[model samples]
Target: MSTQTDSKRRGQAFAGAFAGVAIVVVLAVVFFVVRNSDDSDKTSAAAPPPVATQPSAAPAQPTDAAPQPSEAAPQPTAAQVNTPPALSKEPDVKGGTGRLTKLVKTTLVPGTGPAVQKGQTVTANYKLVKYATGEVMDSSWSRGEPFSTQIGVGAVIKGWDEGIVGLKVGSRTQLDVPEALAYPGQGDLRFVVDVLAAK
Candidate 1:
């Protein structure tokens, strides 16, 4: 009876030890599975969202469309180029034989403004024509700019100094300048001057 009891006791001890080892292995496997699942959740939560790309613009294609019309530049009128105001006739200095010894002034249109005095600045529009040829030499109207000068102070030719004095603003006058008072060796010249302003 004692031998049987000893054998039974050894068998029971061995069974308890085997059961403890099985429980330890199951706990280790459960720990590893839980740890791996937590790592997967963290990795998925930390990932960045995917970006969307924009499409590029297409190039323009050539077409057979007609162009739009633009405004045209203005052409000069014949009156503005060749003719003066209707009040005065063109000068006839070409037929004269003798040298121009005197300065001649003809008021085409009389002005209502104050008289032009010596040392006063004047603004005028003038057309200069050669006396012999009647060719248009220079014109302030043609250039679209008025001429400005101080009068009676030798700032201009002696003809202008003597002729333009005592003229009033808004008057149109003709000056037949002699060679002595005109440009050097330019001969007699005709000027149709319209006095616009004087100070």
Candidate 2:
């Protein structure tokens, strides 16, 4: 009976300690919940006054210069033979002299005569055309230079001899080469010649 009594007292003391620990845990939980509720209420009540967000001003518009109408450039064609601007009509004169009548039907632009001395170096540019057809047959202009040839040395065509006579230096002349002077056995021929230099 004494041993039974001692065990019952011990049991009672253990039950009381367990009850105190449970009470402490419940109080801590309640304190935490009450503090969180107060903090939430204060934040909700004091939401910062609605910030007046101003809309950004539109970016400055750019000013542009008006477009201009451009002029068209000159164009060349094959039939026109525009190697250079259609050579402006050269002075309209026969033998380029106020006098001489043009022997050939077509127009001619001549270089002033050069008194080609006998056996001198004569640099000349020439365009030869068949008088009947007005078609160019041969020309020194093809070489792009006044060709150098000996005058009165029997090396050049006969028409060059007759046409070159009595020509002053730096003179431009048109020659209506007669059949007798050029290709006598053949027909009439037209020659446009420029005497560049004579030595």
Candidate 3:
């Protein structure tokens, strides 16, 4: 009887100890879970808001940023400045007097006037135009006012060699020169020259 009683007491004590250990383990696990959940909430609340936004404003709008000028901004091209005037040449079919010498009275183009003595100066502006087409070939008018030439010393075309000696200053004349009198095979060309200054 005593042996049976002793065995029963020992078994009860072991069962009680096992139950207490399980309860303690459950409490510890619950405490850790609660602490971790509270910590996560506190960290999230304490974090600073994004710097991409400022106070008073919700966020920085992309369109609010300063605008940048594009390389594609409209720019003028060389073609624009060089665009030549569109002038058409109409055909004149009627019976005409043809190359009328009557219209070409005086000789010398505007800017190719007379001769300047050695150490002398003369200024002028000129444009070369075809006699038949009346089309201006080239001109130095756009470059500046005019250019100067000193004559009697032969610094110009042969026609001016004899023609410009006595031309008055500030006079404009048209020199209807034959090819032989001018550039050979260059043919009778017309020029209207201005004598801007003479010294």
Candidate 4:
């Protein structure tokens, strides 16, 4: 009976020791799991969220800035100044009657306004014809506009520069331009011109 009792006591002690070791292992595993979960939460909290990009709806408007200083506006050349104006009715002009020996100027109607000056802009209506052919070559009346040119500045034929300078604003002049004073290759020509305005 004493031997059986001693054996029973030993078995009970070994079973109790096993239970303690099992409880310690389970507690260690639980602590490790909790620590790893806390570390993951800290890492996630340190990072920032990503930003999204978007496009604008409209372009920026221009500001009203002051203009910078520059050179004076360039003056119009002879060709630009001489562009034909709107035309009027045709006049009764007779040409090709006789040969022209030199530049001839005759004022048919005297002007009541100021006489034209050199380098002044002159607006006039003219009819041009061949001295020998009575045939009309060009007429501002036929065209829809009167002609504008700078007098005595070589903007027109030499005869016109010389003949139109002294003519008043309302005068009518007849010019017989010989080949020498007219176009180089063209023959003698006749012109009846009405001065409209000069400035």
Candidate 5:
């Protein structure tokens, strides 16, 4: 009976020792897992955020050449053409026999510039008068502005196209337009023109 009781006591001690070892193994596993989790969180917290870098400014290059003077563009000068004589008032037409049958051009003031070309635009001031009555028909001077038109293009009277061509800029001239070259069915007319510009 003593042997059997001793054997039973030994068996009970062995079972309690086995339970303690199992508990120790479980606690060790839990402690290792908690420690690993804490270590991962600390590592994540200690890590620094990515930093952005700014670009550096480049150094300026030096030039060896001396400073030069800046030049301005040249401006066009007015042509050195002849200036016309000043007129005090409009001219009077005289009734004379043997009136001009063709266009008659008389330059009152000569020009020093190039002669007017065909199809070139011309700007001028003019006075138109009836040949027989000396009545002023139209005058640009009274309107205070010059007129611009392409000469020798039938834009004006035939007499003006035929007579005004070959005249230079700044020329002052008198034109006697015959009946055929003047307005339709109109009598002979006179025009005093001051050529201002041509282009």
Candidate 6:
């Protein structure tokens, strides 16, 4: 009876020890599973959210239409030329004549245009000569361009202002200006003037 009792006690002790080891292994497995689950939750909570993306724009297509003209560079045009008026004959002014005491006006050609007014601008071709010596002084015809002046105004000599007034366009007149009306120091003069335009 003593031997049997001792063997039963030894078997009970072995089973108790085995049960304790199994309980410890189960507790260790549970601890590792809970720790691994908490670490994954913390990692997910600290991570940043994904950002949304914008769509790209479409590329432009080529066109078949022609390009427009630029205003900065313009196309060229034809050139223009100017021509002088026609005259039948140039007048021959005689020189070496006696000095004129007063202003003398002689109409060589009659004009068909209107008479010049006091403030009108006059365009004319002229031939100037000295009264005492009959020397040719100036000729607008030789210059190829006519002369222009405001008549009956103080813009020119007193002789031209007084002589050119009331003269009509297309009329050619001879004027003999005395010393006082022509130039202050220059001698008495003569002018053969062709009236071209007055406005």
**Could you say which candidate leads in TM-score?**
6
**Per-residue accuracy of model 2 over 96-190 as CA lDDT, tens digit each:** 22222324323243335446677665554456655555555555445443445555544444555556654544444455656554543435555
- Candidate 4 C-alpha lDDT tens digits along 49-81: 553121011011112110111122223333443
Q: Each candidate's root-mean-square deviation in Å?
A: 30.3, 36.3, 29.1, 29.4, 31.7, 36.5
* Candidate 6 clashes between residue pairs 3 or more apart in a chain or in different chains: 96-134
Which residue runs does candidate 5 get wrong by more than 4 Å? 1-98
* Over 4 Å off, model 4: 1-89
lDDT of each: 0.63, 0.47, 0.44, 0.64, 0.63, 0.65
lDDT of 6 at 115: 94
Query: TM-scores across all candidates?
Result: 0.52, 0.42, 0.39, 0.54, 0.53, 0.55
Clashes of 2: 5
The residue ranges of model 3 lying beyond 4 angstroms of the native Cα positions read: 1-119
- Model 2, position 24, has a per-residue lDDT of 93
Q: What is the lDDT of residue 150 in candidate 3?
A: 56
Candidate with best lDDT? 6
* Model 1 lDDT tens row, 52-115: 1210110011121101111221223334332335423433323234466799898978877788
lDDT by residue for model 6 over 47-160, one digit each (tens)?
Answer: 886531210110011121111112321212212112124333567887647767778888988887789899776667778777777677777666665666666655556677
Number of backbone-clashing residue pairs for each candidate, in the order shown: 0, 5, 14, 6, 1, 1
List the pairs of residues colliding in candidate 2: 111-172, 111-173, 112-171, 112-172, 112-173
Q: Residue 133 in model 2: shift from native, Å? A: 2.1
